[model samples]
Target: MKKTILITGAGTGIGKDAAFALALRGHRVLATTQTEAQSDVLRIEATNRNVVLEIFKLDITLEADREAIAAYPIDVLLNNAGMGESGSLAEVDMQRVRQIFEVNLFATLALTQVALRGMIAREKGTVLFVSSIAGRVPMPFLMPYSMSKFALSAAGAGLRAEMDQLKKNIQIALIEPGAIHTGFNQAMTNSKYQWMNASSYFAHQAEAMKKKERATFKFLEARSTQGIVNQIVKAAEASRPKLRYVSPWIQGFGIRLARIFGV
Candidate 1:
């Protein structure tokens, strides 16, 4: 069954790839980017790929940008838009953490609420939150981003249960993807260094931590984005979508093992 799916942050990374993949599957995909330049690039890319996509600018944090979703009769709301903040919990700036929450949680929830209104009126829809595996396991220096994702995981679980109780056919799924080579991870890790210095308390450990962080992504981050895109499409089309879709199976499996072993 073809459906109209609205996705945020579709200008690049996993969201961009997923938009094309879903469109190829014959779904009407509204791929929204954070900026007009990104939207233009997306339009050109879609044209080059010979895939049809409704490309537009949508900064998740802006009210006007979010209000645009109301114009679409969306069957699925794919919340793939998110930001990353990497720093030590003890010394990291709280303002950055707050900013992280604004985009990853508050704004995300607000938009989801909007989608829920329409879906509830019709009583059938799917909502997929693109969370991260770091949300489940604590990754050093990535607390700000992880904290938001953890909240997202909780939101997904709690929302799904509420809908189930209400007997609504609406579905909510959390895409907990492991590290993927989307450049986001590298930029996130490197960001801390841009502001860190001798004035910092963790100054001594910062360099070593940065090295470890890069090494981790080099070895663990998947070289391909397909793993995540596949899960997104599955969640979108599932009759009874699962609560969680953790990708790069090995990473997900490892995380599960760590949990069982109490790591």
Candidate 2:
């Protein structure tokens, strides 16, 4: 079945890869980026790759940009646009934490509500939230990002049950991607250094923390986005998608074990 899917953060990383993959699978993909420059680049890349994608600029946090979603009768809304910040929660700036929540949670839910209006009228649609494995566990410096995803994951599950109770054909699913070798993870992990200084707590351990993060990624991060992309495609195409789709099965398994053993 050919469906129209709207994906946020389609300018790079997993989102970009998923957009191209879906388009190649014969679905109409509306790939939106945060800036016009990114949209232009994506357009060119899509052309070069011979993939048909409707590339556009859509900053999810902006009201006007979110309003644009109503213009298209979308079959699926993939909330993949997110930002990250890292620091000890005790010392981190509160504004940074708020900003992450504004993008990762509030704006995402707002857009979901906008899309839901149309989906409810049509009596059918799907919503996928791209959460993180960090959401499942406590990440020391990555708490800000992890907190947002945790809230998002919880909201996604709750919404799914609500929609079921309403008897609407709308489906809600979560896409939990583990550390993929996309620059995203590195950038997020390095974010804390921007604010940390000689006076800050844990300043002395900075180098050690950086080394550990790098080593962890080297050994645990998946080298390709294909694992998560495959899960996204499956959820998008399935008539009754699972409540959650986790990629790089091994990482998901590890998380489950950690939770079971109280790690």
Candidate 3:
């Protein structure tokens, strides 16, 4: 059935792809970007590709933008706007760590609560969180961001159960994508270099760490986002969606293995 869906961070990456995919499937998609420029670019891209969706600017971190979602009577809320930070806990800026939580968790959770108000009032709706496999497995140098996702994963699970107990037909799901070549992961690791230096404890192996980071994504990051977007679409439409929807089954399996081995 066609539904009104609202997606954050829809100008790029998996969010952008999923917006187009969902809209092409005949869903009413309100695809929001972080900036007006992004919205403009998305408009052009959508027109060029003949994708149907309403593009707008919405920074989830901002109250005004978040309020706009409530006006839409949305049937599905896709939380995809998030930031990433990387650095050793001891060396990484504490402020950066806090900021990571602000964007990746606090804002997301708050927005979920907002969306829930409408959903709960109607007693029907779906909330899909775009979390990461990093939430399940510990990746070095990416601890701060991972920490946020850990909380996010927990939030989604707990909220899902909470709504279930209320006997509401509300559905909640987490879309965990691992190492997709969205340039976001690259920026995540690279962000560390901006503040990291020889004085840092890991200074001795800084270059090596950088090389390993690049190699990690180069080898693991999927070249295309088709599979990732497919999972998003699946979660969006599933009547009784699973708790977690992970893309690139192999990567998901790797996460399971790491958890089993206590990695």
Per-residue lDDT for 114 in model 2?
92
Report lDDT (CA) for all predictions. Answer: 0.91, 0.95, 0.91
Off by over 4 Å in 2: none
Candidate topping TM-score: 2
Model 2 lDDT, residue 89, Cα: 93
Model 1 residue pairs with clashes: none
Better of 2 and 3 by lDDT: 2
TM-score of 2: 0.99
What lDDT tens digits, residue by residue, belong to model 1 across residues 113-167?
8888888888889999999888887777889998899899999899999989988
Tens-digit per-residue lDDT, 146-258, candidate 2:
99999999999999999999887999999999989989888999999999999888989999999999999999989999999999999999999999899899999999988
Tell me the RMSD of model 1 versus the true structure: 1.0
- Regions of candidate 3 where Cα sits further than 4 Å from its true position: none
Q: Model 3, 40-109: lDDT tens per residue?
A: 9999999999988899999888988887778878889999998889999887878999898989999888
Backbone clash pairs for candidate 2 read none
TM-score of each: 0.97, 0.99, 0.98
Model 3 RMSD in Å is 0.9
